[model samples]
Structures are given as structure tokens and as C-alpha cells.
Target: MTILNSQHILKNLQELKSFWQDFLPHLNDRCILLMSGDVGAGKTTSVQMIAGELGMRDVQSPSFAIHLRYENAEGKAMDHLDLYRLKDDDDLESSGFWDLFAQKNSLIIIEWANRLDFDYLPLNWQRIEVRFEKLSDTERKITTRQV
Candidate 1:
């Protein structure tokens, strides 16, 4: 299902939280989530809520560090990666991007993922696309696959 706004994504997260187990029965290790969206499209905000659902405390975006690795008290590490600067940083592929896929209990969320080459991304990964309507603050849409 494709949610048409930030609030819609929030609602869907809550709705899907309880039923998450059903969605991924054998889910284990190194999950990848590619979240594509324009600036201020709630990409970071959605990740924060997912972290909250996973019992992660104090979620923060690593847009500056290029990547963030945060593990809550539960030892579940969520890597929030910002590809916003990747357009210029051509050496990112060799700088530990591939290393993250080898980790267990790691969930990576790549914002502005469209900039990266598809070959660098994992196959069969979950994808989400966010679009804005016109040029307004409240105009946005989020579409997901294999959620």
C-alpha cells in the first residue's frame, strides 16, 4: 500500500508494527530499507518512528557523519545512512558500504538512495518512494514495496 502523506506513513507503521512478524516470519540479520524522497519528505522522521517501534531510544539522523550506527539497550543496531552527500563522495562504495551488509542485527536505512548505483544496493531489498505534490508543505506521498 502507498501512503499519501507523513501522517499516513506514521499510521501505517503503527498498523504494521503489531503485524510485523507476519510480514517477515524468518527475518534475521542485515535488513536493508531504501527510502527515496525529496528534502523534508519525512524520510528521517519515518526512520525515527521505526526505531521507536523497535525499542530504540534517541534516534538521530547521521546526515553529517554520512552514516550513523546506534544500538539501543536491546543491542539492536540501526544504521541511518544519508546519501545526500554521496553524489560527490565517489569513494563511498569502498568505504564500508558493503561491510554493513555482512552485519547481523543491523538495519540500514538509506535516504536519498537514488543517487547510488543500483548494483551497490542489495537485491530484493524493501523500497519506499516519497513524492511531493505542487510546492506545498502538506503535499507528499509515500509508496512502498514488500512492506
Candidate 2:
């Protein structure tokens, strides 16, 4: 389901979080969430919310670490990857992200995902685009491409 041109992101966020909790139970493992948005578009904020919902206390951007693997109280690990520093395709190639894809039961949220080529994406991924609009600080347009 794709949400296009939303006026209120906080409301949309409530819905998005609900969508995850309501449907994610059936998946029984990890899922890739490709957040296609520019800086300050709430991608990191959304992921932080997810981490909290998953029972994690801290959620920080791994801009320097490249990736940060967080574990739930139940031992489930969520991998958060930041591609903001990657200058070229070769940087992505060196990341060996494909091997990381093999890790099941782990959620991967990629920042600056649009910077990477589609060929590197997993077969199953939820693409989310957030566009800021209007003078209102809280309004945004979000489009989701779910496969």
C-alpha cells in the first residue's frame, strides 16, 4: 500500500507504525525497509520509533559505524545501515551488504537508500519516499512501494 501526498505525517506515522505491528507478526522474520528520503525527512526518527516498539532503548544513526545491530529483549537483532557516506557503487560493493541480507529475522533500514542502485536491493523490500511540502513543519508526502 502506497501513501501519497499526506498532509499530516504524525498521523501517517501512527498509521505506519500500526501497519508494521499489525502485519509484521505474520512475517516471522526480518524485512527490508528502504527509506528513500533526504536529510531530516524523519527516516531516522521512524526507525528509532520502530526500535522502541521492538523493545530497544537506544536507536542512533550509524553514520560512522556504517551499521548498528540492535537486539531486542528476546534476542532478536535489527540491523540499521547508513549509506550516506558511500560515494560510489564501489563503496557499496565493499560493504558486502548481500551477505548481510542472509541474516534472517533482522530488520534492515537503509538511510540514503535512493543512492544505491536497485540491482543491489533484496527481492523483498518496502520502499518509502518522504517529501516535505508546505510551510507546515509536520506535513509531508509519503509514498510506499511495497512488494
Candidate 3:
């Protein structure tokens, strides 16, 4: 397994785009990107930025819909999921969350992933930990880790 712990400070959207560009080549269809952090830690923002960089325009939070799928700039399928409302495994099962894995060529990004039990998650997936550090009233830092 590749244990990666990389950090980047994103002060603006341009920096976020550059970071995604650098990380794009490392992503693949079988990867599930689990994002964990406190509320307002830029998890959705990160997803939106990555989606935008990958050519998904009009990206919005999937908190209400819980799941969304789109084609990236390369025409690759991308899945965005939110687990904030899931209360248990039965909820997940009923929601057909696991069914998403059946779809090929999916690069899934999940928000509020910390709410789920990690042991039940698919193995060999990438876990990204995002932490928002307040530097000032107008400035903040987005730290990311890949494991």
C-alpha cells in the first residue's frame, strides 16, 4: 500500500486548481477518495474545485441529493457522494451506496466520510484528511493528506 501524507496550503481557487492539476495524474477509476474533516473545513470546496478542474462545471454540494455523477474533462465518469445524513449501515444499504462500486470508470469523492465506519469501507481506497487552519479573518489554510 502507498502511504502518502502530502500537505498544501490553498489560499485561493487558483492554488486549488494547481494542486488538483498536480494530483490528477495519480487518480484512477477504482479509487474512492474519502474526505474527513470538521464542518466548514473546505471538504465540499475541495470537491468542487477538483470537479471544476476535471471539467465538471456548475459543481454544487450534494448534501441534499446525497449523490451525483458527472463526466470529467477527459470524459471519465466521476461520482460525488455525501454521507452526512446516513445514520447507519442500513441507511447506506437502503441508499444503494455500495451499488456505486458496480459502475466502472468512476472516480468517487465522498464528503462527511468521517461519519461512516472506516472498517466497512472498501479496501485500498485513498483517505484524504482536510483541515482548515485560520490564519486570519480573510485567510485560511487547507491541509490535505493522502493515506
Candidate 4:
């Protein structure tokens, strides 16, 4: 079943962390979280919150390196990927994109997912589309839906 489809007005980091705490457990084992928004829209910060919930304390945007992998104490892995540097499908393929997606027991959070071709998305895998809207300097209107 779909976990979240509502919008939240997050005014601070605590609220954001709470949001992830409330939502992360409900995510599927092989979740593909498509995070989309403009630059500095808190996409990476949201992933950081997810990582924190997953017991990965040190989290950062993988924009430069393109991908980051973390594992919790229980061995639940989380792959954080940034596709902003990829030009097209071929670029993604050449960068071992499919290999990353093949990983199991992991929640893959993709920043700048809108830049990637949606047609390549696997049909059977669980997917969530998270869109962030900057409501103010300190507030973000975040929405989620199953895909």
C-alpha cells in the first residue's frame, strides 16, 4: 500500500527528522525514492534525514561523487544517488546505474531523479515520488505519492 500522500509544512530540521521517523519504516524494502525539486530545494537534506533514521549519522549530498552507500547496524543498506551529472540514459548505463538498482534490501534515494528517464524505472519495484516545494526561507512543503 501507499504510505504517504499528504503535504507537510516543515518549519525546521526537527520537524523534518520527525517526518522521516514517521515515514521510513513504512517504506518498502527496495524503495526507489524519486526526489525532485529545483536547486537547493532540500532534496539532499531530506535524504540526510532518511539516512539518519537508517542509522547513518554522517550523510552528505552525493552530487560530486554521484553516489553514496550506507548500511545500518542491522545491515540494511541505503544507496543515495545523485543523477545531476548524468547527461542521458547511456551516461547512466556507463556509470553502473543498473548495478546500483539491482541491490536488494535497500532504499535507494535518487536526487535530481527528474533528470533521468522515467521509462527506465522498473515496474515491479516499489517507488515513491517526493516533491519538495520551498514555501519560505525556513519552511518546505513536501508531498509524497506511490508510483
Candidate 5:
């Protein structure tokens, strides 16, 4: 079931931060954020802002590494994953993507999520899909909907 649907046109970093600050509170403790966008569409930037809000520092894209894990002082785990290089289920299996579902109190943020097959996701998981569209050099239109 859908729980939230919204869109924001952010012209600068400050506006993006403001949007995240207002939207973060509505998320569940254990949720999966599936993000889709072209290169430089602000997908990773949005994750960084959200991590900063959660007291995480130096959040970086895991494009080459595939995945990075962060834990807040409160013991909340955030898994950042980049699936841009992964081509199929075999890659996902090798990357241990399914194992993340066993973790508790986790917020999983996946970039290039359109590469993932949603049918394989556990039924109990709360998934929020976010799409980022670059409007110009400094502007992005981010749309989100829960599924």
C-alpha cells in the first residue's frame, strides 16, 4: 500500500536539505529507499543529506564498492548500495543483497534501483521509490512514492 507521494523541485543544496528534513520524519524505522536517476541527477546527494540528518558523516556513493554500511549513535543501520554495475540476479546474490533483509532497524538506500527486480523483495518490507530528474545544471525534480 502507498503511504506517501510527493514531489519537489530543488534548485540548490539548501532546498534539497529542507525537503529531506521535512520528509524524513514520515519514514518507517526499517525501510528500503529505492532511487532511480541518471548520472548527476542528485540520487547520491539526497542520500548524503538524509545521512547527515541521521548524524552520519562523510556519506559517499558506493558506485565502485557496490555497498557501504553506516551506523548512527542510536544503533540504526543504513546500507548504501549502488547497483549501476550489477547486471543480473547473480550479481545481486554475490553482493549479498538478500542478507540485508535479515537486519533490524535498517534503512536501505539503493541507487540505480531500477536495475533491481521488485518482485523478489520480501513482502513485509516497506519500500519507497524515489526518482530524480535533472531539470538543469542546478535544479532537480525529485518525486517519491511509497509501495
Candidate 6:
């Protein structure tokens, strides 16, 4: 199910906030948000904005840590992952990527999700794939769909 397919100029915070408003309704617990985009394409920024909207503060890119867990005021968990450094399934295993699925209530958000193989995902899991395309220095084309 394609939930959002739109483009926006993300040059300022207001534009990003507007985009978050449009994207927030489709988000839910116990789902995986797979994001793919070139470096500096706003994938992590989008996550930060969404996390802020969810009452989370100081959300940072998990690029160095590979994975980071956050909790909102309501105790909802969101797992942020960056797969750019992972090379293979062994690395994923070592990073505890698979274990995240066991957390039924956490929202898993993966950056560099193009590196992940979809076949390994549980069939019953709800997955949302979001793709970001850099149109210009301040614009991005964001497409999202449930898969």
C-alpha cells in the first residue's frame, strides 16, 4: 500500500515540520521503517524530525553505533539502525539486528536499508519502505509504501 509519494523542499525546519505532519499519520507501533537514500539525503534528518514529533529528544544518526534505542515519554520504543557499515549477515547478527524483531512494540527504523535483504524479514512483520531522492541541495523526493 502506497501511503505517501511526494516531494518537498527541506531547506528549513518549517518545511521539514510540514513534511512530518503529512507522514506522521501513517506511522504506527510494531512496524519497520526501511529508508534508503544517498548519504546526506535527509534520511537521518527525517528520522530525527519524526522522533521529535513523537516526544523524543536529541535523536542522532546511528552511523557510528550501528544501532541506537530511544524511548518516548509514553514509553514507546524506536530502534534506529544504520546499515552502511555492515557487510554481511554475520555482521548483522553481531549487531543484534535480528533480535530487534523480537521486540514487538518497538518501531524499527533502518537507514541504508537498501543494504538489507528483504527475504530475511519475517513474513508477518509490517514493513514500510521509504525512498529519498535528492532533487537539489534543498529538495528531496520522498516515496513511501507498505510492503
Question: What's each prediction's TM-score?
Answer: 0.68, 0.74, 0.79, 0.91, 0.94, 0.89
Clashing pairs in 3: none
Comparing 2 with 6 on TM-score, the higher-scoring candidate is: 6
Segments of candidate 1 deviating more than 4 angstroms: 1-28, 89-91, 124-136
How much is 22 displaced in model 2, in angstroms?
5.4
Who is ahead in lDDT, 3 or 4?
Answer: 4
Local error of candidate 1 at 29, Å? 3.8
Candidate 1: lDDT over CA atoms?
Answer: 0.61
Give residue 144's error in model 5 in angstroms: 0.6
Candidate 4, residue 64: lDDT: 76
Model 6 residue runs over 4 Å out of place are: 1-13
Question: lDDT of candidate 4 vs native?
Answer: 0.83
Q: Per-residue lDDT tens digits of candidate 3, residues 82-125? A: 88877777877776678877775678888877776666666655
Give a tens-digit lDDT track for model 2, residues 40-85. Answer: 7677877787888789877999887777889888998788888888
**Of models 3 and 4, which has the larger TM-score?**
4
Residue 97 lDDT, candidate 4, scale 0-100: 69
State the weakest 10-residue window (summed lDDT) of model 2: 1-10
The stretch of ten residues in a row with the least summed lDDT in candidate 1 is 1-10
Local lDDT at 87 for model 5: 73
Candidate 6 backbone collisions, by pair: none
lDDT of 6 by residue, 29-102 (tens): 67888899898788999899889888999899887889999998789888999998887788788888888888
Cα lDDT of model 4 by residue, 48-136, tens digit: 88887778878888777787889888898888889888767777677676887677667889998889766788866788889988888
Cα error, candidate 5, residue 68 (Å): 0.7
Instruction: For residues 1-147, write the lDDT of model 1, one tens digit per residue.
Output: 323113233334444443333333333465666677777766776677777767777778777677877888878888888878775655466446777877655777777777765565665444333332223454444554533
Task: State each candidate's clash count.
Answer: 0, 0, 0, 0, 0, 0
Distance from true position, residue 98, model 2, in Å? 1.9
Worst 10 residues of 5 by lDDT: 1-10
Number of clashing pairs, model 6?
Answer: 0
Name the candidate that leads on TM-score: 5
- Please report the TM-score between candidate 5 and the true structure: 0.94
